[model samples]
Structures are given as C-alpha cells and as structure tokens.
Target: MPDGVASVTLEYPKKISRGRYFKPAVFPSAFIKTVQVHDNVLSVAIPRGAPDAFPHRMVWRDAAGAVVHAFTDPAF
Candidate 1:
C-alpha cells in the first residue's frame, strides 16, 4: 500500500527484470468503474466495456477510494 493511495508495488525480474514508466495516466474515479493496466500505465475504464474518458490527473486512492496526498505526480 502506498502512503495514502491504494497502490501495489510489483517486483519484476530485474534488468531484463525491470520496467519503464509511462505518464499521462488515469484510474477509476467516481465517473468510472474499473481500473486496468494498459501498456505501462493504469487506464481508467467504464462499466461493461464502454469507451474511457480521459483524466487530466490522477494519483493513488486509498482503500476507501480517497485520493492520496503523498502520491502526487512529480512535477518533473
């Protein structure tokens, strides 16, 4: 679990066992129903396989779906 959001850290097999990060991402919100993995990021989806809406910003949500404060997207 992340400091405040509902996140899971997965360990991959290193070098050939590592991962690359993709930004411009989204997750399930009040308007969305599902969270899915797409490419290297999380994609927010609607119920029953409907089209997805673009989210301007997103961070990890707590187990209760409350947004996390510490997991803000780095302003790099």
Candidate 2:
C-alpha cells in the first residue's frame, strides 16, 4: 500500500459446482475492503496505487490456491 492510493472494485463471474463451493479470491494484502457475490457475479474491493504505463497483472485462485484466472490491465 502506498500514499495517494485509491480504492478499486473488480467484478468476476462466480463458478459453481455440484458438490463444491467457490470462495472469494484471496488477495495478497489485508487492505481488501469487501467481497460480495450477487447474481452470479463476484465483486472485490481493494486499494490500488496510481496507474502507470506498465501493465498490472491480476491473478485469481480457487479454494485450493490454484490459479484459475489471470489478467493484465494495460490502462491501470
């Protein structure tokens, strides 16, 4: 976390299984504000620093700690 950082909200699709449940993705920092699930969409809120030219990578994992999704934001 850094000074002048702003809070960000991200949304993702919630995966459902017959005999298993998907938990909210775990973030590396404790500054995460809230995690909400509604209408099959998962919303995550956290603090983010100012944007730069370099791409920012976001990684998501399942309950087993296995990476299930990854994305790079060029604008953030």
Candidate 3:
C-alpha cells in the first residue's frame, strides 16, 4: 500500500495451463473485490472457494484508478 492509495483489490489466483512442455501460468486477478483502508490498515476476507495453494495479490490504487502499489503474497 502507498500514501495515496484509495482502495485495495484482492485478487484470487486461478491456474491456467500453458502446454505440456512449459509450466502453468497465473494471470488476471485484479478487481475481483475491494477492501476498505482504515488507518492505513486493510482487512479483506478471502473467499471460501479461493485457492489455498496459490498466493493472492493485493493491488493498491489511487482515486484516479491508477495503480499505486501491488504485491503478491509468498512473493511468487
């Protein structure tokens, strides 16, 4: 999260197959839901059906809808 971040988006990972030769790819999990920022602390609920093995992403955005900061849990 950043100083000007107005909202935080919780992205649940969804696995996608690439091919038999290459590993799978993970993409497009932004804006699935948003959480409120209170006193610079954000608390969001993970969906019941969200994948437990993959790490989720948090995308912080400003009021102008520009991404201010983004990070993924487990760093992978």
lDDT of 1 at 34: 35
- Clashing pairs for model 3 are none
Give the best candidate by TM-score. 3
Greater-TM-score candidate between 2 and 3: 3
For residue 66, what is the lDDT in candidate 2? 52
Candidate 2 segments exceeding 4 Å error? 1-39, 46-55
Return whichever of 1 and 3 wins on TM-score.
3
Per-residue lDDT of model 2, residues 23-42, tens digit only: 43333543322232243345
lDDT of each: 0.34, 0.36, 0.65
lDDT of 3: 0.65
Clashing pairs in 2: none
Deviation of model 3 at 12, angstroms: 0.9
Q: Which regions of candidate 1 are displaced past 4 Å? A: 1-4, 7-55, 70-76
lDDT of 3 by residue, 1-76 (tens): 5577788887765654446786866554523678767667876665443444233677888878888888887634
Candidate 2: minimum summed lDDT over ten consecutive residues — where? 11-20
